[model samples]
Target chain A: MDKNLWRWIELNEYETPSVPTTMLAKRWWQKMLQTLRPSRVEVSTANSAEEEPKGVEFKFDEQPLLDSLNTLLDQQNQDDPRVTWLVLAPASPAWSVIRKWANQNGWQPVSMPQRDSLLTSSSVDELNIPSEPWVVDDLSHGFVRHPLGIRWLQNFLRKTLQTPQSPGLVICGSWLYYYLEKTHGGLNRQALTLRPFDTESMVTSRIAVSRAHAKRLVAVSEGHPGIAAAYRNAFAVAAEQTEIVLEMPQVPTAHGETSTFVIYALLLHGGLSTFLLGEVLNSIAPNLIEHSLNLLRSHGIVRYQDDQWSVTELGYPAAKQFLAQRDFNWTSC
Target chain B: MDTQKISDLFKTVDSNAALQVVTIILIAWLIVFLSQRLLPRLANLLHSKQRLYTLALIPLIRLVVVIVALVMLVPIFIEPTLKNMVAALGALGLAIGFAIKDYVSSLIAGVVAIHEMPYRPGDWVTIDGVYGEVTHIGLRTVELVTPDDTVVAMPHEKIWQHAVLNANNGGPSLMCVAEFFLTPESDGLVVKEALEQIALTSPYLQIHKPVVVTVNDEPWGTRYRLKAYPVDPRQQFKFITDLSLRGKQRLLDLKIEFAKVETAKVN
Candidate 1:
């Protein structure tokens, strides 16, 4: 399904991210190629089906497609950041489109170096992701899904980012989208509401996820403008082509990060230093170091010192991975 | 004629000198009696440190007394040498073992069990897939505490043959997974939201609670699985039941339907 990704490997030593749940990432990649080729216009999600008013004759929106193509080519012609774009849709998963876009760009896509790339479905299963204690039964805890899902999703995103040339992207399930964002040190990523039916209540919720933080969450609706005000910034038009800015969304993760930062601050300030100890994060009530630490630890981003914590070595890697594998979800970043 | 003359001549010897036949045997029996009944009382009167080992050492001490008694009896009964008595006892062992075969096997198993330590008093163990707390250790039997707080008595012989898995050997906590299925049409977005909320709100939350979920396509709908941690394993059944109830309720209110989940056999 994602054969073109092979071209990316030949073109770059870097890895091409595997299939991403996000439709935008693949579309962005395709757009980049179309933009490169002045004569060719790629499929636009907004116009692919909509342009066919009464069947028979239809006109595709070539502008956005044209823009993606031009941007990709201009970058390639001038040796800019490999700049692959993509999107997630029913027709395309991010990696599936990444390969197509890469092939069209005339770059030899990278293929599996060995029969055993970890991203392969076979590899993921083989890894047999160690089941967390919470993965099976936390009935001891009243929660429905274990919190480990957030961690796994984050790990999945990180893995996707390792792909060569092709932009790193991921498609997160809407169910775990927001929690993962809130818990991980979510960065300059976009959130996408993969709409099944575009209902009003669902639109409201989607709007909430989109606008919940200052970051721009792209809403992938079937047709309707869909609760326009719910997004951090709304872009809607009854048009044949869809226009998505390539710019990364603003990060509003400060809310989650701030709470997390408090733990890191206390730990570094207290445990790592002498004078700061006992003065701060002393584990005493009023001090309630545990309480503050709990908030910080809830996010997978935090790690511990004597009584302190900070982001892990894996943290920045996660952020970089998030950028590369920008898949659509409750939050794309 | 010689035999008749010897019988007449031997008539004057007292029973004490009657080859010292039964006199020494009676005295040995007397010594055993004093040790069994008298020594325990002496220990109690003196409040001796050996008092703790008394219950533990009774069978061993008794075995020693009988062995000593038999040694004394050999000289009196048959004028047998020390080596000859040992040989006689060894010869009789096959007959004794045949008479009480199961007992002999069980006694041997008990010795193995002491060395093997499949379980000991106070160790939480699961045997024959029966999990519980170990409460008592006896010569032939062991007691366990069930989740329902019932005492389970098991024979030492069973422990020797069957396998027992110890949960606490790695660490007391056991990781468990619970799964729920819903229609693919059921909004995964909604399901994930509800599950995370439930996990955070759960009272039985552990210190390092690791709740997780997976969404897979099923004929009925998306298989939304939630795996969470339980505070105490003993209450696993209740935790599952509660999760089922709340899960059903949460979905019912949202009108999320459950998928009749079953695995397909490829073969």
Candidate 2:
């Protein structure tokens, strides 16, 4: 199997084999991933010895969710004669573990030092580049917020972005985040206006609000409010295009070997839909609670700490409010 | 003649000594009282868990308070006795050192720990084979809770002696292993490419990225491991679990055969 292919399966490539045993394992894992979407995953492959991974090494970068995606498309990469990189995502805690494990194994030999970004990319432009301040902010505004910190990151990424410059592939929504649509991030400094838990539909609605602004609202006239709310459930409906095949019944792959696929489910009926040819759901335990947390971290809201979790700089206030609503009684009024 | 007896009684009292004893007692009491409110507040605002180190502030505070109070009250206790007091202190210095040897050493160690801040509350640390989250930082001892959830109180002297591993130095991020076994003939290059592709594609990947792809020395086949990160440090198991299971599934779909990795031996 190709190393990249192994990574696809190891990362659960969003789909699984249809055979009985593979299907059973897939379902079990899907259940786990569904329940723990935003949580870290440690797979134990030991046969006889039952030992947990050594306690964590502290300094990790993938605190937020969008950060992982933004990192995937970073500019600076190492030059490898033998290795071929098929894709790259934003750096996340999960990706870090994979890189370290791969290097230790000599699957990528020592002569090849991993290529890191020339400059540390700013989470803002990376997150904010997706048009609509509220759109990106709604995804990431929770974890980090500092002007110098944001600027330092921007200057760094702008430098790296200048290098290995490639025409970006603008899928359904990436265009908006990269400032293709409007002068976003004007009123708001941070990316992702709402908390990470907010749905893609909610983010789109806020994006419409920002895009309309005063002049656009004047142009839209009386239908402005309704037009803004139009995209509320658009992405969610589109997200269903993810043919999870929760029930893999008749996949045509090898026997006794697990198979993963990316089925192009519903075609573009009228609106836009983007699909990733993924191997598995990035998350393991995809429960409702974890779902929200996954959404939050994916958007760069909070972080994971030593055996515990907490909100990042931007998430502090909202998380505190959430705690008040979750732990304390704030509904009486 | 009765006045002579009263003067002799005054000599016995040793007013200066009385003053030092009273000052030490009062300062100690004041320090104990102030610490309850101060320590918790520092832990909260400062986001620290080193209560012992904070508590160490108490003794130092008390010492300062007593010294200041003594400096101001010296004239009242004894007249023109600075020189005489120094002579007296010199005379008793050796005797006092012999008596309070261990106590003085502990006091010094306590002082060093407070200023140095080797560990703090809410930090996961391992010392002398005992690993756990720090619950308290004491003057002479440090308390931590182990992963399986055991509370361990280790001496400060012990932590200083052995190698201490701090898990959450600034934030919690841990290295994770996602293992896969493939048929020995399976192109290691192909597998490496796919592994790299997965790491590149996964939304869980990070910038200060993890080192990846370790090929084992085993004969059954090659082992491809992706050391990736979780969205957060606390979620490492879930992160690695998803990556491993997914990576394996992807390879299988590619008609990849497998030699499952045997049980590892770590001696």
Candidate 3:
């Protein structure tokens, strides 16, 4: 009997039948252990022989996802112990998968404490956890407007990297990933973006769905797992009655003489500088053009950035509707 | 003098031939009506920048249909031979040319206009001091709609003796000029920049083209002229109006006063 086989059988909680006396039975037992040995020994575990396996292999429903994640972690562990894996994915199934996988593998998963919690809780208490391979979830929270939150996150990441006991870190969430990359240059971490299931996968997952419905699910969700799951749930209950309504913001009509011209110019050419916009509506008083632009900006129809003006996403549909209602012909310029 | 020869040279008129001639005329009329009506509708239906180009083809299509009808009718009414038709047309053209010399010249000019393409429908042109957009190019006359909404029919023969000023030629865009006059003391460089900015910001302004501001220090005041092209020729007036209004307001904002009317008139 191979010593490594006995270790895998013990780690996987597989029963080690008393060494078979017959040659055929012993060979069968060795072959079965050999098949499971590859999966169990791939990831290094520090489980002691006296410690009993708490859960069976088939207990968890997401066995395939767990297996894949274990393989990924094993590869990452072997490659570089210092590099953290930043997983960018929409919240829901992905976050759950990462949390479960980390927990099962005896790696600590920590989320960014809520803003209110952070204020009350001690930073030392949160950072000093008794586990290796910590997973930081939702690092983007409070980073947008909170300078203190950004400093705390940076400090935490720095401390985590210096700790020899902590093997690695996994950061989750798309916004958090983006915010971290933009703010902290990704902390020199490897990134993995988990995308929502495509149409073919969706069809394979759902037993009772037409191909068209699967396609519609993909479109409606825009490939966000959380949104797709919500849409699927809604579709399941009232398949025929379910309706997706896209509500477009309405653009107020340009009442002033030059307002129409200003809006039209913005619509024609997506972005323009203040100087260029003034030139387009030159017939209107410069004062009036300035006033109109300010008004449009206040209404959230247009945005000014870097000395250039552009209509907002909400402004496009509204402007189109407004222009169509007024019968403003672009053909006549 | 040779009556039998002339009679033989001409095909005898019959009911079937007459019906065929009437059918041809009807079809030609139908084509004319459709081209005049349907083409405009088609141009409207087509949501594209090339709508004007499509509209310009209407007159050409009408002209081709009429010519084709005439050609088709000639063989049915008269002997369809090159030599005979030339002899007949030669005599008829001589008498008609002498009687309507101006009409002949206009007709010939219209033909040349098609080939030369000096002006077409949707062009902004000035012929013999009349400035307007060409709405229709007829066989002998070209119809224009002025800014005042007045329709003027100018004969094609004017192309012979007068120079035609086509602002846009056959293209969709046309240049418009807006003038500003300010006191001599006002900064020339500042005013020029302001005028150029005014044109650059106009909604109807075509940014791809250049916006030029010219200044002249006249005795009356510094004359500032801003020249720019509008995206469409039809919007020339509106584009100019926009530029002028904004330019004036900008000048006011800069605390620049306009030249006195009496002084401007003197210049």
Candidate 4:
């Protein structure tokens, strides 16, 4: 057996060879076999009695969130049954956790169809959505706005609001949340934002770990469960190899005069023309702005396209953190 | 000093001592040359607000190296004894001091300039009537590159006679003013708010810094000046340009007109 397979089997407490396998373990075995065979390996499609569901298991603490959501739903059930509950969160482990929680609570979890699927259907009736209270997962994948998706959402909201005894709805994901928030004005009070675990919660959740290490994880991952889990896994493997703890990564400060200006400008304007940026930094010569932008580009912090300069995904967090440290709100910008 | 002692001081310069002195001079020159060539490139490559501070160190570093070289060469060119060196330096100083009074004064002023630091290599300054960015702070003269790309070498002796107006001092940020002339009949409140917004919305405006709008009623028109700081001193002109162009457009949008210009009478 491969070392990884052995470790997985041991970790999951499986019998050596004859134990009933889960869907995850069976899939892993199939992947290993395919890699080993390299030529004409047929994957068996037989269903097993002991197969587990094909969904990720979220291990983060979500009881408080569940309790809060239940309270909101109970209140709505009494007062306004037609209002749809908007559970706004970044698309990650939080979305998955909310979906799983809804499923466990007897609320039917419904995954949104892809953008292409929605586009192909002419009427909302053709899609055949369930009338029962449903939790919509992956509401906006890839953060790209689709007009059809917006139309479908608007239609659904209208139908739900028109019905006297409507099933309470739960919508998840950031881009969709932003779109709804902007276009649909009355949903703000009904929205429940799901945030990641705080520093104290993160520290207490782990067993036999130092508070310093837990704080390091929170700082590095920005309290995102998926990122924290990934870092933990990497740290475990590295610790096994080196038998030493890794030094914490140093966070970059936004104290640099020009850097602060560039980041602030990009955040406020979303993007800026080269000429306008040069004008904004008027004391700097045109050549210096080009040189500074080139350096920022090389660092993967800033990107230039169509004569406009903007911050990249990698740069956004650093910029946000930098601003936050200085008591400046990136959202306000 | 006696003639015999003066002759003896000259005779003390042996081949070995001469070689040491030459070697020190060469090393100092190389240090200066390489630093001059490399530091600016490094600073530019780094591309941060720290670039100005980094570039400023080059002149100071060169000065230190030269001073060290001269100190090392002093003993090699003459006798190593303190009494002999002091006597020789005193005699040489008297002759050079009288012969090159202005040069010596400037040299002493250069030392004071380094200590006082009225301007650095990257600072924007105005000395006498010339305004420019200081490119090099040399021993006797400061090299400034003007907005028109003219490099002027102004001697340090002028520091005694004239004030050096440093825009940014040693920092990276500098304030710029954008002035607009509107008809006296225009609403001051509306124009003031609009000008304030222009500064606030400017891409180059330093948000942490204050933006001020002041108005003065002139005989010709109402003069409105928007004073704001750019993120960097180098962006002063551009910042002013952005404010001016935008402020004028805003005034035009609000239906405000400029004051009519009066022709000057030539004598």
Indicate whether candidate 3 or candidate 4 has the larger TM-score: 4
Query: Residue A222 of model 1: what lDDT?
Result: 25
Q: Which sequence of candidate numbers ranks them by TM-score, best first?
A: 4, 3, 2, 1
Candidate 2: what is its chain A TM-score?
0.21
Ranking by DockQ: 3, 4, 2, 1
Q: How does each model score on lDDT? A: 0.39, 0.37, 0.59, 0.59
Interface RMSD of each: 26.9, 15.2, 21.8, 15.4
Off by over 4 Å in 4: A1-266, A269-315, A318-333, B47-49, B80-83, B264-267
- lDDT per residue, candidate 4, A246-303, as tens digits? 2222112222445656666554434567855655555445776676566556554567
lDDT of 1 by residue, A72-190 (tens): 34444422222222222212122233344444545443221221122122212221212110011110111112222122333444543443333322332222334333344342353
DockQ of each: 0.00, 0.02, 0.06, 0.06
Model 2 accuracy (lDDT, Cα): 0.37
Candidate 1 deviant stretches above 4 angstroms: A1-333, B1-96, B120-126, B129-131, B179-201, B209-242, B260-267
Q: Poorest 10 consecutive residues of model 4 chain A by lDDT?
A: A1-10
Report backbone clashes per prediction. Answer: 75, 127, 21, 11
Report lDDT (Cα) of residue B20, candidate 2: 69
- If you superpose only chain B onto the true chain B, what TM-score does each candidate give? 0.48, 0.52, 0.91, 0.93
Q: lDDT (0-100) at residue A302 of candidate 1? A: 38
lDDT of 3 at B162: 97
lDDT of 3 by residue, A1-333 (tens): 111110111111222122214533643454344333422321111111112322321111355555656655676562344545545333245556666777777776564555434323234234553345666554544232221223455556677556445566565444344334433433555555443445565555551155555555554344444444444443342234444332223343334335556666565444557865654443457887888777666555566878777655434433443443333432110
